[model samples]
Target: MSIAVQDLEAQVLGLPPEDRARLLERLIASFEPRSKAQEAWMQLALRRQEDVRSGKAAMVPGR
Candidate 1:
């Protein structure tokens, strides 16, 4: 990786857990959608993520 990217990575890695998670969400949002269908799926997944994070949903273990 280039020096600038390396430096940025180091800085991001140094962030606290909550700050890193916030940055991660922003990074994921910055990606261009591949298609409308895929974008809709991603939006659903993000909502589910929020539900779990907010204690409105629970994850089930696979059998």
Candidate 2:
């Protein structure tokens, strides 16, 4: 990795957990802003995740 990247990574690592998470999210989003279809899928995924967390859905082991 380049020195600039190493420096930036070190600086980011020194940030608080919340700041690090926020930065990570922003960095990921910067790569590709979600399209409407992607946004809908993300919403669905979040709902499904909540359902699983709430015991409304169960995980099945795959063979």
Candidate 3:
């Protein structure tokens, strides 16, 4: 099941308020969990944040 995100976004934006709310509810429920690679990437992101907070890593400008 594939969708063009931009087209869907445009259609959703054009909907009436009540219909938009209903459609958004269905769309939210249809989303699945992150893949293994995504999970690994998220873990790395969290660890990097922890390292920065503990002064073990330096922040880069414009990040």
Candidate 4:
């Protein structure tokens, strides 16, 4: 690999978690921003987690 690319990668790695996540989200969203859909799914997932935790829902072993 090129030294310039390697140095850039090192700089990126040095970024804080929040900064890195923001940069990554922008890069991916360049293709298409599904932020709303992502938020909706996250909310639904959290609700499902709460349901499982409260025994409002049950899981069974599967093969």
* TM-score of every prediction relative to native: 0.48, 0.63, 0.48, 0.44
What's the residue-level lDDT of 1 in candidate 4? 50
CA-lDDT, candidates in order = 0.91, 0.94, 0.89, 0.90
**lDDT (tens digit, per residue) of candidate 2 on 1-63:** 457988899999999999999999999999998899999999999999999999999978999
Candidate number with the higher TM-score (2 or 3): 2
Q: TM-score of model 3 relative to the true fold?
A: 0.48
Candidates arranged by TM-score, highest first: 2, 1, 3, 4
Using lDDT as the measure, what is the rank order of every candidate, best first? 2, 1, 4, 3
lDDT of 1 by residue, 1-63 (tens): 457988999999999999999999888977954789988998999999999999999999999
Strongest candidate by TM-score: 2
Q: Supply the global lDDT for candidate 1.
A: 0.91
For model 1 the TM-score comes to 0.48
Locate the minimum summed-lDDT window of 10 residues in model 1: 25-34
**Judged by lDDT against the true structure, how good is candidate 4?**
0.90
**Model 4, residue 29: displacement in angstroms?**
11
Give the per-residue lDDT digits (tens) of candidate 3, residues 1-63: 888999889988999999999997787757956689978988999999999999999998994
Residue 27 of candidate 2: its Cα lDDT?
A: 94
| Model 2 residue 20 lDDT score | 100
Off by more than 4 A, model 4:
1-34
Candidate 2 residue runs with Cα over 4 Å from true position: 1-7, 16-22
Better of 1 and 3 by lDDT: 1
By TM-score, the better pick of 1 and 4 is: 1
